[model samples]
Target: MSDEPLRIVHCFRSPVGGIFRHVRDLAEAQTSAGHLVGIVCDSSTGGVHEDRLFEAIAPFLALGVTRTPMQRHIGFGDLAAARRTLGILHRMKADVLHGHGAKGGVYARLFGTSMRLGGRRVARLYSPHGGSLHYDPRTMTGRMFFALERMMERFGDGVLFVSDHERRTFINKIGEPRGRTTLVYNGLRDEEFVPVEAMQDAADFLYIGMMRDLKGPDLFIDALADTSRTTRLPVSAAMVGAGDDLPRYREQVRLLGLSDHVRFFDPMPARDAFRLARHVVVPSRAEAMPYIVLEALAATKPMIASMVGGIPEIFDEWRHGLVRPTVEQIAQKMREALDDPIQFAGLMPPAESLRARFSAGVMATAIERTYREALRRHS
Candidate 1:
């Protein structure tokens, strides 16, 4: 191998959600670190917002990007896309193949093994940023996904988990070798949080993320209904992000007579949404170190979140913010936060410190170290 900068190929299903942001940040950081970075993604299907967003971000980095007509869902198209990916990898001569999300992981393993078998020195790494493993095994789809994951282990050289809880849950579910996995937490750039002048008349609570069921948008509205019955503090809530469930959530808000108390905004740039409120609420049924939580912490905003996934790892006690298990508990915590502004202000410094530990720079260094280790093993 030459002493030239390591060439990396990053693969992801759709350039959306936390996975997209993570891959983008890593690619920018690697480019800055003097490495050659390239990205491979499914081509744009006209009118898809996520595809357009990906197209926008692709050209900003000092790397090449190749998009094939791959579908996210399993289909005949994906098989052809996999072959295209193999052809791209061969041409790029990538030293490392890094995959993000479920479809990306599948492609990386399938084609990466072919490269390895052909006596190419390419290494494979998969990052499952909280994929189907979060699904409860009581469902048939979840069980099948677990089995598929177990089968994929034979092809992957390393797996990067975004949270300790997720790593533990995955290891227990798939029985993968412990040595093959590493915990690489999701991180935020400092510019991700913009300070808003302490709004004297802003909304009392805010929720950011896709307006989907797993994100608990409906439960948040239900909690607001519960809070209004107990207190007449004139509380207001902001729900941000766009999803397939937006219409249903709007209907629920109207049914609960929360039309005046709750307002919905289409997803804006994240910093703009974070700066619009003082309190951030994460009522997700499941998560794996959501960037919104880290963003809230970076902005020194108080938070009330469900104690799920990697949330507990971010804050120890109520001093930083509150963590609970149910919608009722989330409402109680919000009420408490509204009552004690001084106590909430006391959480800022500690929260900032916690946020710094997971900055984008730290995440990039961890990933680069992993890439080097993978290369060494293959050598």
Candidate 2:
């Protein structure tokens, strides 16, 4: 193997949420190491903010960004999507095709196989990121998706799981991966570790994530109401995000008569949203090493998050702050945080511990090692 810089392309459907954040961080780190990185994702996913993010990361991507209509479901559309993605990868001569989530995984693995058939070598990798893993195996759709997942494993050069729990889910649901896989944790930058001072009139709590039900935005609203009623305190919250389910959540807040108590904002930087509230709540119904958890913890902000996916992994020894993704549990936790901010803050692990475990530098180094190993095998 040579020490020359590698050309990398990340294929994923939507350029939003945690996956987008993960790719951006990885691209920056890889670029700093003199690697050529690029992104291929859905163009229809985001608004102005996403366009800005694309521009910010454009400097690192030698292949530039390739945006096409990559849908969320399995349909005839996938054939065309795969072709577009494959064409882009061939053009980039990508040494590594790293796919994020389900659609991205399908595109990357299939495209890698196509390249191999055309006498080109590429290391194909998939990171589940709680995509298809959220499906119930007993359902027909789940069965079909899992079966497809099994078929795709053959096309993969390897898998890059974000957490051990995700790897376990793959084993339990889709059977053991036929080849190789590794657990690579998501991470954050150095500046994020500093303590954040809440705005003078910040809300009592913050909900910063996609405004979808899977993320438990409704649960956040319900918990806020329950926390208000139980503690008899005028609890206030700021929920920041955008999604298809946003209108429904907005209606819910209005129906609950909390239009004022629960303020809403378009999706912004997590740090900015963190400043609008004293504490952050990640009420995700499911996940695979959510970046929000790492972001909030890195900001030295006290948080109450669901004990699902790799969230508990982040807590590690500090389990007091983790809770079930439900209204009652979150409401109770909210009551505690509201009752005594100082006490709740004391429950979180120290900033130094989190910084050591989840830094972007460590994450990038491990991933680059994985890429090198996969390339060797591909060669």
Candidate 3:
């Protein structure tokens, strides 16, 4: 241990999505700061996307790619994969195990707890990234998630919530001890996010993210459809990012005869995708801190998003952009946003200020401090 750099392992079920992006950013930051970083994730099957994620980070550090044979569904395969992950942890001799999301968090906690019981000094950190806690408490799954949180709380040395709202929700629902939880806003390298000059001629609203049910891609289409009916403005919408629901969403667009008005593009590098749009929309049913919103804010693009999760914390009603409750509300906000030049201008200063707060340097420093603290605690 004395001769080695801090051996850090980031465990995630898949090396994709916003959580994966966060992990990549941290790994690069840690490597630059002179720490050894490694990642373990599921193997890529043919036709499986997210290969770009591995490609993006491989050149930066010593990455250990372990492919877990696990189906995403809740069954025997997942348990077998968890066992495989535990074996990997034992082999890696990781000093700190940082887990992202539900499956990763559970596996890391169990592994760390077992190691601690055996007199091994391994610290554990869990970043939920808005998993079970993101659901409304009225449902059965939400209740089960609450119970799971209680079960897992004892195993974690520290819990990091991406937003204050997420932390507050966790405290409110689970009654977990507040002292162990910390709020670490997701950060991105602002240098990578080149700002697009507000396009005076760009015609469509842009939505970039997986086209999953919770992301509300359909709602964006529906809102665009309604907006077209009410206004004479030739509004068009472009969606980038493919998912299991992409074909079904394509059918919905065709059934609405909106093939021309609504277009779907293959997911491109985030910077390239952001350059092609005028306004960004995040209509997710739930989120913790979406990197898309941070990227949009960093790009200084005006946005309209759902008033859920950490979104309201990111943007005030009349400050950065509008945050609405429903699709119709989002459409109403869009119409209002288009009509009000003064309000849009008012948003720029605050947006720019917000962008600086999430810069990579700031985030790296915060995370480094957290890592040091965790190490000190273990010592």
Candidate 4:
């Protein structure tokens, strides 16, 4: 493998959420390491916040940022989108085409293969990022997606999983990958390790993430209501984030008579949201090494999360303390957190252990090594 700088292009569907954060971290690290980096993602999704994030990283993206319309679900429109995306990528002449999520995976592997016919060397890599794998294999939708995953396995030089749980899901649903695979945990930056102090008037708890049901925003609301009802404690929360289901969650809050206690706010920085509340709650139904959990732990904030997806892996030995993704369980945990804040704080994983295993620099170095190996193998 050549030690010279290489062109790296990261392709993904949405310019929001964990996958976006992961790409941003990798892009920054790779650019700092003297490689040309670029991003191609859907234009329709993010708002001003995401635009600001793009602006911050725009200066370092040597290959430039490109965006176009991309539908979340598979449709006939994909043909045109794929053609346009392929043209953009081919023009970049990327040495490594790394895709995140399901649609991006298909585009990277299939389009990267097409680019190979043009007589240039290109390493195609795909990271599932808990995309289509979230679907159940027992359902027709799940069966179709898994079948697609099985078919696409042969096109890529490598498949990268963010967690062992994600890897296990792939094997169980689609069988073993025909191509190379590696597990790389999502990571945090050095500055993120500095603890965030709660504001003087912080609420009892914080619910920060997408407002969708899948992320359990409703569960957070229900848990708060239950905690207030069961304990008669003056429980309050700050719900931060935006999604299609945001209004629905607001209505649920109103109907449950939580309008006075639960205040909804637009999405903001996690650390900023952390300041709005004394404790953090990640009530996700599914995940693939969520960055929020790492950020919360690194900032020395006490948190309770659902025991689903790769969360247990993050918790490690503390995994036994994770609550199931249910209102009853979440409410119980919330009550415990409210009752003894110090005890809840004690459940946090040690900072040193998290830094060693989940640093952005380490993640970038390992991924860079994978890129080199994939390039050599493809060559």
Off by over 4 Å in 1: 1-3, 43-56, 69-72, 75-77, 192-200, 317-320
Top candidate when judged by lDDT against the true structure? 4
Tens-place lDDT digits, model 1, residues 106-190: 8888788888888888879998888877767778877888888888888888999888988887877767553478888877776
Candidate 3, superposed: residue stretches over 4 Å from native: 1-4, 44-49, 198-201, 316-320, 340-351
Ranking by TM-score: 4, 2, 3, 1
Candidates in descending lDDT order: 4, 2, 1, 3
Ten-residue region with minimum lDDT total, candidate 2: 80-89
Give one digit per residue, the lDDT tens place, for model 3 in 1-379.
4434677888877666688789888888878877777887767431334676666667775646566764554577777788888889888877788888887888888998887777788878888898777667888878887888788888888888888888877888777653477677888775855676645555557888887878888888877777777776767777888778999999988887788777788877676776666777888888888888877776767788887788776664444465554778778766766677457645743555676667766776676666667767877
**lDDT of candidates 1 onward, in order:** 0.78, 0.89, 0.75, 0.91
Encode model 4's per-residue lDDT on 1-379: one tens digit a residue: 4779999999999988899999999999999999999999999999888998999999989999999888999999998898899999999999999999999999999989998988879999999999999998899999999999999988899999999999999999899888888888888999999999999988999999987888999899999999999999779999999999999999999999988888888878788888999888999999988999999989988888999889988888865348999999999988888888888788778888899889898899889999999888867
Per-prediction TM-score to the true structure, in the order listed: 0.90, 0.98, 0.91, 0.98
Ten-residue segment with the worst summed lDDT in candidate 1? 44-53
Total backbone collisions for each predicted model: 0, 0, 0, 0
Checking candidate 4 for backbone clashes, the offending pairs are none
